[model samples]
Target: MADQHTQPAKLYRMMMPDHTCPYGLKSKDLLERQGYEVEDHPLTTRDETDAFKAKHDVETTPQTFIGGERIGGYDDLRVYFGVDKPKDQQSDTSYQPVIAIFAVALLIALGLSWFAFDSILTVQAFQWFVSISMCFLAVQKLQDIESFSTMFLNYDLLAKRWVPYGKVYPFGEAFAGIAMTAGALLWLAAPVAIVIGGIGAVSVIKAVYIDKRELKCACVGGSSNVPLGFVSLTENLMMLGMGLWMLVRLLG
Candidate 1:
């Protein structure tokens, strides 16, 4: 049987009218009740609605369809929900993973609650990592370069100049990433201390799976490891947490 908990697959964006809003909200709630995740693109203007119609070739509003066929609208939905498929029909199917994930999260929370001595070392290492990364990222964001032009130009920050070829930005970014990596190693002190370590790990995980590989590999381009898009986001968030930790420690 098809998994009822599978989210409703949305293939197109939609602009909905206020009159249709009630029906749409009801449909979404019912979908959730039946154990499907529903995502909606509520549209406001006629132009926006027209754009969606043009884009996906959808005919009407307040419709329930999957794989481009009209499943049924509110009236059909009313019948389905009325008797054949009751509200609790799919609720019995256990989503066992949720229980497992919750257990793990609870364990982690308890571990974090316990006091530890190395928390100080964690704070120091995390702050050092954040400072260096902030310096590097501030520089990279400042060095805005086009992807195609990067094939021919380069920039050097430590040397304090631009070479005008693709070489400069990439090389400088690479060196700067080493600074971020150094910061991430602070996790040994608190595991949660540097904060950036988790993001870096996830980024590294995602980068390996990408096939087109368009993102700037600030960490290791020539080497086997390639940088992922989220790597930078994770790095920034981690550094922010680390910096906050330092301020709190110093003041407290």
Candidate 2:
């Protein structure tokens, strides 16, 4: 049997005057990692790269050939080496993107609070974190209201009955968030938060726990892959807390 390490892999990648294809370097590294001796072919100019692509009848660069067979691009190379590309990048059922947005919003909230009050952890900072996170999530929903409404109707009892509630929900969430962030319009923000949050909590619980229906969450957006359950429930609970707190402060 021939040694796999002795097998040569041919790689054609772009190397121009002003740009170098990063995927090409990645492919080379992967090939080496897989114990293959790589024959690097650098297309040094635009015309050269274009000509090579034309000859190979392929559209993209960093093409790989192993054992006298075309192995496609960087993703294909990973597949060949049995390396799993991130599921979030290729699959639809991933919570990583929503998690990332919340993570960033938390950091921003802490930074803003520290700059304004000289403290990273405080009641006001926590409020800001929830408010900003709400706004961010609302924006995602607003990007595709139609899609959001469809997904929302699957579980939200109010959305299923009224239908327009799905369309109006994002705007209401955004308005509540903005009002809370500014520490103004407590009358409007508090009621809006309480009503929406209450309904959302009940709807989520019934769908996930009672009916045992597994579904996607529309908290981050209509198209999000975040599962509809714990995270969604937590979001509603946070809103409830914010609303009650604001209402108490106003009353006191």
Candidate 3:
């Protein structure tokens, strides 16, 4: 007898840019074998796609919903249905950005140290710290990969990578912490520098979107794991002012 374990008793609507999808077929086959009502929605326009999501409360393509709870993108649901290995079971995902960020931060730290020795608490020292810290923040960006995946991948390894309702909460919290710290540090050192940092910070804050929280953050090269939240607005604004101040010097 065919293995009865692989099927999901759910409704799945597949959205695609084109009809040819090898990955989706494999997913659909798996869903069908499990007794799912798989509906293929051939998207011809952005408006039609938007209509589908609104009708179904679907935030993700290849959306797999079980009794209305979005199980997630189909592949992750497969794992949820025992189709793939548990995420933690996999090896530490290569934290490529963490490694790279650390290297870059090291350079910034060195520069900061050099400036500190030359003068007692000057703008140059503060600037070095801000530069290195921005690079250091690449750690968060690295961890934000699960967030990155949602924008491109059909299958999600972590939790729901793309949801239409709200993903900004986490990104807001994280960068806020860094920005607050950066801005406060600069505020103490140089008032002008904080203004420049503020602009970039605003750009980052504006970049916050519902898609940003698609997956759990794998911080510090996957060494740290924490859920994201929205209380970060305060700190992020602070960093925004300081970082923007320093940045303006570069442009002008």
Candidate 4:
């Protein structure tokens, strides 16, 4: 067999007037980075690209070929090079999405407070931050209610008892969040927040502390890879605090 270093890998990529295929560029770079010489084949026109695809019996561009073997696209190239592509895995639980939600909510609240009251650090800002976060979290759950309910039922006591509660939970959360955001209808929002938050806190505590069951949290939504533990506990506690704060303000 010929030495791999002397032989160049063939790369067919699109280089059109309006669009240059990003994956094609990436494939070229990857091959170069892996110490392989590349015979770059740039299809300059749409028709040319289409003809190349038809002739090769491939559906996409950025196709790589080495020693008469097809190596597929950018993702395939990574796999062949023994590189791991980023994906959500149970072993690699992340809280980045949850953190980002809260961070952005706080910034938005701060901006609103500055515009309305000429201040960022205020009770209203805190309230808005929490309310916005609730709505965002609810949106995540609502996106795939089926998946959220399944994960929720694993730990949520109420969801386990009343199967329908899992489905209704997102709606209730959204309603509470909207009401809280408006700073109106305390009678409706406060109770809902308190009831759900209280129940969630208790359930999380029981599952994590009492039973010591290791599971994933559906807090950021059903598809999240966040672990069921302290972060989840903190979320429930924040809701409880918001509910209590609203109640005290309304009563006082």
Candidate 5:
């Protein structure tokens, strides 16, 4: 019987002249990190790779083998090592993306404040935080507007009434965010923010609270798993508050 430490893990991956498989590199790195002596096998040509695939009865490169037992691809290796949950068992809900965006936005606002006024806690910084958050959220929606619109139509009253509103929502949020960030064009920004934010808040309240519907939020993007509820409500309320505040400032 071969000693576990003495036996090398086998890694078969694509290392073609023009293209190297990233997952193959990742698999190699993961193996090395786990203290395995890797026996690297590079498939240099398409024909050679195809032959290897045929022999192995596998469709993809970056196949890993530990102790003569095939461990599959990088994702599979992660699961094998308990580094990641199996795909089917992984939770569909995640707030990490939204939390990350807000965290970064807050940091940026504080940094800007210190740069401008030599103070991290200022009214301007608060404004920056909200406006920056709005901008970031808008950018997320704009990434795949069609997908966002489709998701938006699920619960948005205005989107149901007027399909174009779903398409136009991100642009309006972006416009309001930019104008508010600059503290300019309050006349335009305030109304855009107020209307959209007001509608959004009501729609969310009705859908999540009143109707008790379980839906995915399009806040961070169409494909995000962020649940439609408090986080969505907060986003709308922030915009509503920002718009009303700006309107008051403009009137004053």
Candidate 6:
């Protein structure tokens, strides 16, 4: 009689000449990391893959079987091994990225203040923090202008009427942020920041409060899971405040 305890984990995955399945590689890596010996069975042809799927009554490739019991696909295997939570349990909201960016920007601002004036608690530090945060946020939008613009149009009143405003928004933001960081060109930067920030704040309030609509925010990026709520509102308010402060200083 064969020893069932010593039997290796069996994995069937698609590995055709034209294409290879990524999930298959993930499944293999996961099993290896868990100290399991994988007996990989590659389906080299479409017909062979179809036949395997039909025989196993599964719709996808990269199927795993441990102790002679089927373990569906890569995601299924992850759940089986307690590596990930089930899809239904996962939360959609994520604010960690934005928090991390702001935190880093604050530290940078403080560091710069200490280096320049030998103090970290100066008003200049606060201004630097706001400007640096804006720059970071602008960079995130610039990563995928098209995607950011598309998501922005969902609630931006100006973008809705003027289609090109969505695309131009990121560049404008970047220019304002850079000018603020260098403490130069308040003539142009102040107005740009004021207008954009005012518009953004009003749009967010109308969509989320007045209209009672739920949507994703484009503050961080297009693919961000951050909801259109307090954080988004705060971002715009900060920009508006910074712009006003800069304008006052410039005039006085």
Give candidate 1 misplaced runs (Cα > 4 Å): 7-20, 54-59, 67-70, 79-252
What's the distance in Å from true for residue 27, model 1? 0.9
lDDT of 1 by residue, 69-126 (tens): 4455554565655634644554433324223433443443344333333343453344
What TM-score would every model get versus the actual structure? 0.26, 0.78, 0.28, 0.73, 0.93, 0.77
Q: Please, what's the RMSD in Å of model 5?
A: 2.3
Tens digits of per-residue lDDT for model 6 on 1-252?
Answer: 145336679999999999999999999999888888899999999999999999989999999998889988999988877787887987798998799989999999999999999999999999999889999999999999999999999999999999899989888888888899899998899999999999999999999999999999999989999999898898888889999999999999
Which lDDT tens digits does candidate 4 get at residues 1-252?
336546679999999889999999999999899888899999999999999999999999889998778989998888777685533422467889899989998999999999999999898999999999889899989999999999999999999999999998889889889999998898889988998889999999999999999999999889889999998788788788898889999999
RMSD of each: 17.9, 4.6, 15.8, 5.6, 2.3, 4.3
Runs of candidate 6 with Cα error greater than 4 angstroms are 1-8, 13-21, 32-51, 103-125
Give the clashing pairs for model 2.
none
Tens digit of lDDT per residue, candidate 5, span 1-252?
335545579999999989999999999999888888899999999999999999999999889988899999999999987899998999999999999989999999999999999999899999999999999999999999999999999999999999999989999999999999998889999999999999999999999999999999999989989999999999999999999999998889
Query: Model 2 lDDT vs. the true structure?
Result: 0.89
Comparing 5 with 6 on TM-score, the higher-scoring candidate is 5
User: How far in Å is the alpha carbon of 232 misplaced in model 5?
Assistant: 1.7
Q: TM-score of the candidate numbered 4?
A: 0.73
Looking at candidate 4, what is the lDDT of residue 162?
Answer: 99
Task: Give model 3's clash tally.
Answer: 19
**Model 3 lDDT at residue 36:** 65
Shift in Å, residue 127, candidate 4: 1.1
Over 4 Å off in model 4, which ranges? Answer: 1-90
| Model 2 regions lying over 4 Å from their true place | 1-9, 12-62, 66-70, 80-92
TM accuracy, model 5: 0.93
Give lDDT per model, in order.
Answer: 0.44, 0.89, 0.47, 0.89, 0.94, 0.91
The 10-residue segment with the lowest total lDDT in model 2: 84-93
Model 3 lDDT-worst window of ten: 151-160
